[model samples]
Target: MKFLASFLILTMLTITNSITAQNQNTATKTITVTVVNATSDTGKIGFALYTKDNFMRKPIQGKEGKIKNGKSTVVFENVPSGEYAITCYHDKNNNDRMDFSKNRMPLEDYGASNNVMAFAPPTFENAKFLLKDKNLELDIKF
Candidate 1:
């Protein structure tokens, strides 16, 4: 009888732990992004996500956002808790690089989130989110 009881207890513990882990994986928040007028009718837009520490990496790969026509809406899933920002540019030539004029000024349109607040490149603090418990929504313009 004692052996049976021990087996049952062990089974229960294993089942409970499995369920807890599954719940933890499912406990993710959704991010609602609206990329408006991302490009002119003849242009395409490229976007990227970056963590707080590595700010200089060009065209941050992975984490693909959706684009249809001139606008896009994306939901980044399974994002672990951290600081992040989104930056984008209008690639008129689809050349995978932001074209520049002779003056080094962007010949193509470029933008970032929270662009309304400043004239400088936005800091992580300006765009960071806790994303610990619920969904988030942000609107970006170019």
Candidate 2:
């Protein structure tokens, strides 16, 4: 029947559209961060990725990369499009946290996205960058 044929065609079209939308929504890209100028390549590099709500307190994601030839490269994959900030420090002692001096300044080398510096802690807005449906490359220096 013509009615049956039409119904079948419409159903197929709906299913195809749904699949396309899902693929679009799930598309993601990689964020590559290269940390350079490390004081030494003796320890692991600890890094964190932050969003507005989780800045400093909690990282949406965290990673550690081997320090190689006085440099390190970290990657965050499958990242959805949004605003983000990155912070990293050298864990020379392998204790997994940044060291501070008696004056409360950092004792270890550290860097952030945009290489932002502040008298106090830096804000997310100062270092935030947008990631769309494409790969991003960033470099931070210690």
Candidate 3:
């Protein structure tokens, strides 16, 4: 009787663990970001995925995509449900970073997730979007 009870308990635990793992796996989804108005297809478009804590300072993920017909697209996969913001810039010079003029002005075309347009940099609150239970498609224009 003791052996049978232990076996049943172990089996139940195993099944519970398997179900939890499956649930965790299904909780993540994809995010597709498209830049709709790139000035020219001379170079790649650089994309950064940001969370609240790392907004503008560091990115959770970064991707670069080639521009096609004045548009560029990038996909971030397996992103768990949370709040996120996106920033992208057309890297016209292919220098792997956004160029700035002497007076702290951006030289390249750039935009944020919410299409925020301001003199200062975009804030986390202004550009944030919720990623819950579904994949997202966002179009940004510059």
- Global lDDT of each candidate: 0.67, 0.89, 0.93
Off by over 4 Å in 1: 1-30, 58-70
lDDT of 2 by residue, 68-110 (tens): 8888998998888899999998999999899999999988888
Question: Order of candidates by TM-score, top first?
Answer: 2, 3, 1
Residue 10, candidate 1: C-alpha displacement in angstroms = 10
lDDT of model 3 at residue 91? 92
**lDDT, candidate 3, 25-79, per-residue tens:** 6788999999999989899999999999999988999999999999999999989
- TM-scores for candidates 1 onward, in order: 0.67, 0.87, 0.84
Whichever of 1 and 2 has more lDDT, that candidate is: 2
Worst 10 residues of 3 by lDDT: 21-30
Best by TM-score: 2
- Model 1 poorest ten-residue lDDT run: 58-67
